[model samples]
Target chain A: MMPAAVAEPMNTGTPLDKDASQADLLRSARFRMEREAHWRRLDALVTRAEKGGIISLSYDETRDLVEQYRQAMNSLSVARDISLDRALVAYLESLCSRAYLVVYAPQESLGGLMGRLLTRGIPQAVRRSALPLFIGFLALLLGMAAGYRLFIEDASWFYTFVPPDLADMRTPEASANYLRSTIYGDERHEGSRLAAFSSSLFSHNTRIAILIFALGIFLAVPSFVLTFYNGLVLGAFFGMFAQKGLGYDLFAWLSIHGVTELAAIAIACAGGARLGLAILLPGRRTRRAALRHEAHDAVKLVILAGLMLIAAAFIEGFLRQLVQSPILRLTIGWGMGLFWLGWLLFSGREKKIRRGRS
Target chain B: MTKKRTRKSGPRIEQFVPPEGVPVNFTIATLGSRLGAQLLDLIITYLIVFICAAGLFYGGMLPVEAETVLIVLLAFLFRIPYYIISELVWNGRTLGKRIAGIRVININGRRLTPHQVTARNLMKEVEFFTPLTMVFAAAAMSNWGIALLLAWVLAITIVPLANRRRQRLGDMVAGTLVVNNPRSVLLPDLVVASAASVPEAEMFDFLPEHLDIYGTYELQTLEEVLRDPARRAVTAEIESIARAIVRKIGYTDPVKSGQELAFLSAFYKAQREHLEKLRLFGTRREDKFHHAEGANADTAADPVKS
Candidate 1:
């Protein structure tokens, strides 16, 4: 059966003066009758293509599809101008858009997509974002040094910088044993406790990374501030440990997972800074256009950062607590850091082949 | 062709003027609807997290450590994938957005990519979740944190209100728009029965002046009124509308009370024909008001006073 509205004739009630409306209806009815077959053919082709792939159509069917699409577009224009039927006009609009997607839109396979993202998309995006990444890292370092100096000068500065819940190890009056227990956790309940700790830490870090990335839109100030704040906390902890002569031990402990965790946060901040730079100094492109272009690379960096955070969580939870040896902890930390640096530098680079001609 | 006016207020109606055809406007979704859709999505995300946590605890598949880790990971990660996957699969519509009849669309008319979806949703963490966390988790300890969180929330909310496009920070940053999905109802053909029943003189005679007062858009609207039985139920209301139209078009003929619907129907038909005829000659009127000044210029040049 024909669709509900398309086949139905217009209800132009009898009147000689209203004969023009009747004539218009008759014209519409004739137009539909003449072109309905082509419309149906196009609809069937589109439905098949939508369900499977447009490549599934035979060569003749493909040719016919194009022909039918053009005819439908012409019919739509005519119907839109002359016919006062809203439903008919709407149907044509829907049909034309469907045909447009099938005819013009690019289709990609899942395997091809994954391959592209890994090989070219993510690495290229990261490489492009180098400037912002460096800026974010510098801001973090500045904050860390400032925080460390301030806390060392005034012990009370720790409370102002670090939230109480997160100040587990660095509290001024806490005993050495209490600080050690907070660092290594309890031996008997280590497994469960570490699990909870790492999980919470992962969530907190992920939340911060996302926030850093997002807040870059407001001229990048909040993102820079947040990254600096993260650095300040780390510095405050280091300063407090240094006073107790446990700075080296704390360094080793943090390095176990800190390499990956800190890099992830830094990468997220880089993404945010990229966005902020786009808005602040769009240069030749319009602000909107620059933002759109930058968003592509920024989003990729954020995704990579998120993946790194998961890895960090695993390392922090299980390995950091278990590996009590300072040398082993430092070795693992440096090794992982080198691996990340190497991957970022060389993972997707193209090599020139030397060919010998005989 | 009339020059387009620069919009200065309300959510931007992104006008899709096809390369060779008339402009079609898609209005950005209102804040109320967007909030409702977001609330639904948040509830769904919460439920999923709760279910997974419950499953991990009850199943006892792993030790408490592994379970705790897994649940925490799930809590942090589940919502992200939920949004990203749903939008990717459904082309910018999550289950909640689908239910609320809104969909995310790239304003530049390109298909929404996965990266765009990820960017917009990730920004939600900054715009919504981060501040929410501050308010709920850290409000008691720091008044500064509370103030900052409140300001962040207020700024994001106000951004959409102040912008012409109703774009929140996420939308602006990601360059996406949430819009009401176009819903087309199958209107029954209005010309079939009316053609056969009414006598010749019963139809109102529409002069060029009466015909010029409306275009196809208004004609279609009048057709809808005529088609709906409920609209015709109140004779007085119909008569008033009919009278208003008559006055607007400077139709001096007196309309009897019962004949208002018939007059509307007749006028709709004449206006439609006039507009279509104008279109045939390469003259297009977007609406009656769109060409009023142009029409006035033409009338002034013609030296015809009617």
Candidate 2:
């Protein structure tokens, strides 16, 4: 028995007859318009074929051409030898031609491209690394608690060995002087090369922080270790400073930039951890495939972290050293830190409300 | 040139023959399969991510803050690119999906497009956070209960129940479907063979504009079957036949995979002509076979007539 031919419903929305209304086509078109599968296939074919010389149209060009074909089909009263299906095929071919044009188009502005990357790709990357991002935040909080415990507790185990000469790592009077210099901006050091060098060093350190976050994906183990090391160093630095009565001075110096810088560090670690997980245990996928998958996710977090580092560096240079009042420094530092944490956890990028409206 | 015959007889729905001799799964059986597969995937993915993060934490390379962020970030990103690349390169089945005897494809059994993968995975939050997931979590509370429940919901609700052969919520939103792919046959990891060198269009018999009807026949048939949304097992022979016809005259450019053949057939019905020819041939051959047998039977019954 011969298989039967059934005229399935057309998704084009364009009526074969002259009397077909816009609403008629629109009803069907909604399904096709929103059909990612249809558009995606069309996009792939057009892009792939454009790699060859056969299809050479750009994205907009292809979209316009396809629209035109649909319009042409709608205008016609009778079905000529060319069926609706045939007309669609022609439009797809045109679309492919346009995609090819884009593939072969000349490379454009880096700044513009980078902007697009940040605007479009970064959010996706952030979303992908959300798991690690959350965990990393928790780790940051824990690390801070650990630092407080190690530095503030007078009877802490690390401080058990008391050397008479090491009793004063900082002096109360010297700390007060440093605090004054940080807040009032020491006129003596203004416009000096030493200030410039210090600022540069601060910037350099932040960049390194960004790189650590980015490269953590390459090797998960190292990224984790580096993050832990930073925490340890921070604990030791504060502990040593406080023992000598310079804790107030250190707070004024660190608070301005520490808020943003510390957040960036946590974010970077999250990005790195995202990549490492894909590598260490790929579930059912081979390690290579999992790694590649994880790396893309990590890259997004790294970029966001990079932005944070830049912000931190600017604050560290301009505000940290200039801010002499320890109380003021504490307020600003804690406020910024709290704001960031709140944004990261509950800002909720769902944007579903906007989606539902559309 | 062979003229393709149209199957124009009135609709006679045969008791829907299961394709490729595969059994039709009932609702219970299909749901069981989907649920089982989801659990497996969830366990595997979480374990991998947790272990890696733990190793990194212990290694001391990742700082405490970084480790916390890493955990949150990796969990979400795990399925995004996995879905995207697998759909594009591996034709929708990740290694996990392949192991579980399921794969994601277009509504019309075609290799997944990158857009489809991105769309489906992007909306993963919806599936994971769907009310159904919440209900399931309440039913299965534990430390990993929420995550495990979500994983199961994805497999159960988003995956096509074996009986319906339609879409799960994720598939519906993403415009993709999970099909049974026993052996994961991937599209060639196509290299940019002609990257700077634009190969001249090979001169074929058909011109780009002239082949307007290109894949209409195949496209129309595909659309018909897909509209019904039945999860019918496609036979290898049928796949080849459809693909060969579509490739020969569907578009000016050639398609690479059988999945592509099925895909193009939905949008372009020009290949319907070729399909008609196959139907005609099958019918004619069957008639001839019966005729010869009848003649042979007559001869045996009466030798003089022979």
Candidate 3:
């Protein structure tokens, strides 16, 4: 295959042809010469490929050819000292050197998009990678439950760890009332209209979610420690009901929406952690270069997380209420995750430009 | 199809020759190569810190705070020099890049100049600011000022990725090139039967560096072989010998086609035959050698006519 040499128009030098009118002669002659030169490079590439006994030259060769080809085009002259064929050959050789760059060329930009998804709204309508959410959801379910068992089970001292209002809500009677209000979406405030239970939960959950995103950026380690800590607290919170024989009811109440919400939080952690790793490691770039490289990828992970949060919010508001079927809730959550995964792998209109060889 | 007068006096432009430069290994730009160098720098900094700490603890010399400050200062001090020296001395690579088969060079395949090295390294500040803003935002959340700073940093970070050549702020300023350091692979000769009646290009005892003279001689010999039927069978043999000799003399680019080699072989034989005739006709050895080996072979004095 002939490698394409990206050419820029020449500003200096004699045009290949001298006979045409002076005004347009340089432009027209240069164009004609460049076109011919381009073709010649293609021929040379084919010959080099045959001689080298390789189907294609390495990416390095392709890149070099592109630069050389462009330069040769710019340096075109009417000296007749060099043939068009030689110029083309030199250009193609340069292009063959750069062919490998095409492979990793888009990684930085793609990472950027992923970062945006984790931090901002990625529109549930938009497609996203499913693996991260699935992993996150699974971790939240298993990890939080385990952490709660180890840190919060049957420990009266746990009350001292939380605020009085939150600790008071852990009592059996308060838990039952909270569950009833969450399931029916019918709890009313004692004072203002804004004091509806659903609105209160919404405001509180949004604040926590925002906190998670913000914390993730400082350094990945602290955010990670905090995420696991939250999981432990959530586990202990639910364990109180389990000990009272209300475990199944508690599961049904939280699992309806926690699947998506917790997954988003985990992904956000991963994004921030990625940035921290970039700083600690930096590899071949300076600390600054390494950070920039990692930030690009971390930002993309965060963007994906944001989309998951939006999905979680919808489930929390709508499905958490009037949907007592644990089986149906699990199925719907899993289905949404699958759809997101499929979309991420297959979104966007990818343009494939295949040039026909002469 | 424009009507034009064909001038008999004018030489054929298609036959005009051009000079070729020394061949060089082409390089590929890669993040892996770029990243590997960064890792090496970090390791060096850490190692230096370890050494200083060890000296203070074991030798009982430097104070604890002094050692701590020294470590901090060392890490900061190495950043700019590490980037510039490695890029200039080793071509965008450190020990790791050298091991990974990558090097930094100019886009023109030349060594990076000092000015180009300085320009690229100084721009490291931009890349630093990109994530620094994010760190500030995350650490001091709820501060609108921090978020604004983060946004400013993000804007600077995006510029390098948006441009072609995948250059970051530093790369744009430096004009240095990061390229693949390919394995040192030597091209084997496409051998043929050695020249006999025609004097070998190597036998001329001229410096091998003069490839243009040799290339044109071979081209002329190929024309002669095509014109004469007797030389056709040995044409490939002659061309191969000439090619091997030309390449040995550091004519980096060689004719890839077997046919082109054959043509070059014939051109060499014809030129040698012409030289032999001049020698036989009582021509001066110096004049004959000049006619045989120098530029403008076609315009050389024809001894037969004299």
Candidate 4:
């Protein structure tokens, strides 16, 4: 099975057999001897590169290493074509495989990659995800309406929509005055306590956003449901305040930071949706192939959302209560939204335009 | 005595076209090995977590509330991002993978970028731990909802088995492949000790009848013996194999007691020389049983009819 040619009954005593066999042996042996040093050299360089990275090799050696790999690959092809010793063939194959990882793998610094992903990769991915983002945004709005209607029909639905710790004094039981007081919060604890609260919220939001993205790998419906459910919780809180004639007041309280925060969540879910939709509609490509580019795009969306959440948390922590006027709060919130919309659409366009022109 | 003869165990090889466009064969890491590597990583992570908790509990330096918070935060910090940091720093190898002699690589032969590494490792959170969280969450749910959760976990578990690539969810999303890091040295040529070069070495002469009885597999086995480092130290294996070849080929020449390895070297050269001649005739004798040279003849047709 390893042979490249047909099999025949041997034992021909012709004198030509010995000379031919001798020539073949010399040819194979000489073939190995001529390149054995280079193969061995490649083996050593690859080992060092793998263990200590490409920096382990000097400039001349690095250049020599590629040449050695090319030569070894040539030897492997020759050996296979001529059908040399099995062990020799295996050795060459192994040496080449090991060398390939070191020789051809990405050798660029990771810092530059991060810089690129942030300024360009993130926006490019976000702009490409307009449909999924819209779908996610629609789901959240639909959930908000459903949650508000449910809460009005039965105040007991409040507990199901919001966690007890987060609900704090905003529950159905709390008086309107107390609910307003909690919204403005206590200015006395605005130093460390507020900072701690902001950091915790930031981490929680980031964690939830990432989870939505990860769960999207399943088919995207989970991410959609989760995003909708998140909106429901917010709606329930809004409804509880509105029932007490504090709806406008609470909108001002929440909107100061809610716009960016909510959009971040929706964007994160859209990232996950990118993956789920790929599986749902792989088109001409296999699900795996379709996922290849989408998964990366999804990660960028998640990271962008994460960065937004950080900004939202800082605004929520420091600025929301400081600016008490309802008009100013809504203005700040809408301004952040406009800023993001502009950034995502326009950040990475110039490079593409220049490239096209060139 | 019919000794156990093991054939060359061919592992799963995938052809990767590197940047230079040469198709190189990479031996894919098997599922068992990957599982073992993950298990090692989990064990190592938990050990650290356990050690931290035990120290904190015994120290009694902080209040129980503070201690609890610290323990939970420490475990989360260590367990979640451990894989990403480990793989990124080691350039696709965690300590566990390094120990297991396997490493992750980009499927399309590109460098494993940080984005791919981060996304894949983050996926470990979903694939492995989601079920644990789901168990508690589903406990309050109705029966059908619980069943749905179980089905989701089962589907995730089966993804690796769905393909020959053995890609789990993380690998699928990240576009990475795991392969065994092969290690080998090009040993000296087994044909160097032929009769033309060293008379003392090639003491055993192989007639066409003797050479034709075995083929490449047997020749390679003979080469293994000749090149074996312990061939001189442990005479039994070398003697037995040499004796088997001599008896099978009807090699009448007496092999000197100390020269069993040398005798193997000589027969190895002659057999290879005969096979090479056969190769020139476009007739490669694959093994002793390769005489079924026409259609419907498989490698399993080991009649041993000789």
Per-residue lDDT over A259-328 for candidate 4, one digit per residue giving the tens place of the 0 to 100 score = 9999999998898899899999989999888987788788888888888998998889778867888899
Off by over 4 Å in 1: A1-68, A98-109, A112-115, A190-193, A351-358, B1-12, B15-25, B51-67, B135-147, B196-218, B235-267, B282-306
Per-prediction TM-score, please?
A: 0.81, 0.35, 0.33, 0.81
lDDT of 2: 0.47
B49-94 per-residue lDDT for model 1 (tens digits) = 8988888788888888777777777777655667777777666778
Off by more than 4 A, model 4? A1-27, A81-86, A163-170, A187-199, A316-332, A352-358, B1-9, B18-22, B43-90, B132-146, B187-201, B221-247, B253-266, B295-306
Each candidate's fnat = 0.39, 0.01, 0.01, 0.41
lDDT of 4 at A85: 78
Lowest lDDT block of 10, candidate 2 chain B: B187-196
Residue-wise C-alpha lDDT for candidate 3, range A203-294, written one tens digit per residue: 34533443443343344445566576667667766766666556676666666677666766777666545545655666888865565545
Report the candidate with higher TM-score, 1 versus 4. Answer: 1
**Best-fitting candidate, measured by TM-score?**
1
Docking class of 1: acceptable
**TM-score for the second chain in candidate 2?**
0.41
Model 1 lDDT per residue over A1-358, tens place: 3223222223334444444543445455446556767877898898777556777899999899988988888888788776666667776766766665566542333456666776667777788788999978987888889989998999899999999978855597787777776666455446688778778887877877888888888888988998999999899888988787788888888888898888888899999999999999999999988988899899888888887898898789778878878889999988888987877777676621121221
Clashes of 3: 54
Higher-lDDT candidate of 2 and 3: 2
For all candidates, state DockQ relative to the true structure: 0.36, 0.03, 0.02, 0.32
Write one digit per residue (lDDT tens) for candidate 4, span B1-306.
112234334566778876566678888898889889988888888898899889988998876656655665456556556787888888888888988989998888878888888888767767876666778788688999898888878888799888777788889999988988787766656665444443455345566668767777777766666666776458898789878878888989788787876677666666776666566545556678655454334333323112
